[model samples]
Target: MEEESGLSDVLPRDLASLFSDTYTEESHYQFCGQQLRITQLYGARLGVAAPVWDAALNLCSFFEEQKLNFKGKKIIELGAGTGIVGILLSLLGGDVTLTDLPHTLPQIEKNVSANILAGCPPNVCALSWGFDQVNFPQDYDFVIGADIVYLKETYDLLLCTLQHLCGPSTTMFLSSKMRAEHGTVDFFQHVLPKHFNVDLQWRNVEDNINIYKVTQFQN
Candidate 1:
């Protein structure tokens, strides 16, 4: 999720301002040997789901760097702001679902439509963490998220949603920028460990971004 001041009413004003660029109407990214032109609504009242974030870019780079094949895999991205990560994976041949709150779907849909180069275009849906998770299947091969764990209030809801979506064999890739104010480090180190096995897959030290590989904790 992109940083926003109003998201939970806890994000600091200055921190939100750092990621919210009002002048950037679109963002271009190159991944999977393809260029992606993503439409962004940065200044819109859409809160945190409008613009692209560094965590999303780093996650895409991590996938490409690891040569992870998404061919024919069933994947879903939670809090898919701007739909950049899912769009890139879809281009790599994954059947990707990009989901966020109802009000945020239009922007994600627009980005998905604008970047449908080949293979199946990613599906866009409204999924409010724990609330509508039942509407989605739990058989996904992969569950992915970018910068979605910032709000401490949403921890349980996010955990509930993750439990519903991840099967025993499913793997999750969550990329987050460590923000002391937002308690992002606590979410990865303490909260998620109780139910999921979390491993640090990659770290962009300069950017303070960490990509974690997660899976259900089997008894």
Candidate 2:
């Protein structure tokens, strides 16, 4: 994970493909120009949060490119499975809140506790999509989600959750690998625009991942 002679730690597009693989147990990554070490505590369950995936890595790289000094900016990561993105942002200076289902909290908290030693450690909370009132703070400068739009039934709920968390100016970063055959991408496209203005920020052709930057278009 050597920097190829640049200020940013982002790997070149050609070299990023080398990292695409299913992480089984403990693994280390050079994320956003820093060493990100992660491990899987439990077995790989069907619905449970697992280890790092390609979309997560792409989101990390996208954050680096944005160059928004995260320090003191309140951020929220929806469906924060491994909490990798939120943890990395916290390390970089963001005050992050990592939210997921109740069952997913243990693993996410474990990752957050292990990785975030200084600065603002991310707050791990249990959150279900489409709640009228969430337990955690609602206002955030940015909301991030990675590989979260995979399920067919949860599309609207995901949008609702984002709507609830975001302020009028909150910018959201969502990364997902296309699953057109499963209607994942189409459903997301249909629902997302109703809430925010969606723009394709970057695409990783090698990994088939799309990172989108979303901003609220209405009050």
Query: For each candidate, what TM-score against the reference?
Result: 0.91, 0.83
Q: Which residue pairs overlap in candidate 1's backbone?
A: 1-147
| Backbone clash total, candidate 2 | 1
Q: Rate the local accuracy (lDDT) of all candidates.
A: 0.85, 0.73
RMSD of each: 2.4, 8.8
| Tens-digit lDDT track of model 1 for 183-218 | 789889988898889999999999999999999878
Query: What lDDT does candidate 2 reach at residue 213?
Result: 86
lDDT of 1 at 154: 82
lDDT of 2 by residue, 124-144 (tens): 877778763365566789888
Clashes of each: 1, 1
Which candidate tops lDDT?
Answer: 1
Which 10-residue window in model 1 sums to the lowest lDDT? Answer: 2-11
Candidate achieving the largest TM-score: 1
